[model samples]
Target: MRISDIPVPDTTAARGALALATEYQTPALTAHALRSWLWAEAFALVDGVTGVDRELLYVSAVLHDIGTVTEFDNHSLSYEHAGGHVGIALTAGAGWARERRHRVLDVIVRHNWPSVDPSMDAEGHLLETATALDISGSRPGDLPEVFVREVLAAHPRGALAAEFGACVVDQASRKPDTAARRLVDGGVVAKLAANPLELL
Candidate 1:
């Protein structure tokens, strides 16, 4: 669906998170983040998943890559961990309860995990799947053509594969023990080569 047609949570904290995320991320990364949320929402609807806090999901998605930004990047921590910490700091100002704040953090940190069982945590699972779809073009056929078209039309993946790959490669270069390093060492090049958008 078009970004304007997608359902974003209408909350002050959610709005604030979006604004902050936009300010922190590059245009391509910001589009990736926004598309990630839309893909997650689409999957959730298709799977009949319920009880998901869309606001929490939105916040988590937007902030998921904050650690990659220069200001939030931590030399000592994985980007996921750094992003989670940054998310917590940002949400704390929104006056979220401690438990709710932690929940958002959990979603951010786990979104980059190699795998997640959707039955275990809906938000985390969806985010993981959505990110994979966006970055690797892993399962685009699972989503409807119209929906995919609208999302890409709104948030065009202008060199996203190259840009995102460079981001991950840069992270790997700087942090030897990071998941990004593992991904690169674990055939991420082939995966990116297989990305459907590469042909475009």
Candidate 2:
């Protein structure tokens, strides 16, 4: 796996999140998670976003999509909520305090939100914006084009657009009132297909 120049935050909690994602998530999903973290870091730097809990954001990045994977998929709950629960369990295993664990859960769940206020939760804001960039190429100009190509070269999209889209469509089919449904109704799958990042 070629890694980009971006230095992923390495901490015990971050490592744990990576391990869990690698073990349980599909390769496409894993790469998306990793890229999400990279995008989060890059966005933070470019936007002068400071004082964020880097480890928390990284952990949320890697764990954010695991719920969509087969083993962790919750039939009833939306993928983000299920993933949030998984994040809480994983962080609790790492001995995080209640507040920290809650933060992980909130970040994971809110990453799918329409928008997150940076002032209220910097980590959530970063994760939400980061995922948007990766999944739909939102705010593409925020990071340098060269840096984006470097990241894509390291963690190629593979079948992420197809894989994630199919999973989300299925989720929407089953859970009509979820964010997944909203995303589907809102043409998210089409946006994924046409994501400029993939074209790059």
Candidate 3:
């Protein structure tokens, strides 16, 4: 689903988030493309998530990387952490319900994978997997093979997830860091840019 389809408390909030994300400059075109792609994925996934709080996931995913857009350096975990507080304010401003807001906040706060609760799997699992797929890159070797196979390929959610993951990596690879890091702008953008078809 598109952001327009979602009932935001304030239409401007979504626009504002886009404005905020675009306010930075990265050395990579793929970085910018990745960010744009992930935002689209978040919207798509929100519409597709079942038995889950769509509003909460949507907001959390959309605002998951507000901080990283400015000075991303492959250090997305910190951005995920920093996004916690900002996500709350944005979600509330966007007019998500109170309980839903809290749920979104919880997802943002714990979205960091491997460092947080590896065992406490929840809806955030989808978020984590989606994010990872993007970071892993398009070439398959660029990203975790398991992510592409399990979350992006095997699962129904993987259709969007995998496509977005491969797209971001291929785009981001257009500009490789000095060390061949192939830095994607931020975690959020990197994930959204994962569409392999774009490369094909």
**TM values, all candidates:** 0.92, 0.95, 0.46
- State the TM-score for model 1: 0.92
Ranking by lDDT: 2, 1, 3
Q: What would the per-residue lDDT of candidate 3 be over residues 1-200, giving only the tens digit for each residue? A: 23333344345555554454446423232232233234324523543534554445555666665534444423433444555556666667878677756665567655545323324534465455544444443233443343334333221332444443443454346334321123344553444445452342
C-alpha lDDT values of all predictions:
0.83, 0.88, 0.45
Candidate with best lDDT: 2
Model 2 ranges off by over 4 Å = 1-6
What shift in Å separates residue 74 of candidate 2 from its native position after superposition?
A: 1.2
lDDT string for model 1 (1-200, tens) is 44566678888778888897888888888988988999999888777777888888999998888888899899889888898887777778888888888888789878888877877788998899888888777787888888888888778777666777788899999998888898788766667667775453
| Alpha carbon lDDT at 15, candidate 3 | 56
> lDDT score, residue 50, model 2?
87
Candidate 1 deviant stretches above 4 angstroms: 1-5, 197-200
| lDDT of residue 170 for candidate 3 | 48
Instruction: State the weakest 10-residue window (summed lDDT) of model 3.
Output: 25-34
lDDT against true structure, model 1: 0.83
Best by TM-score: 2
Ordering by TM-score: 2, 1, 3
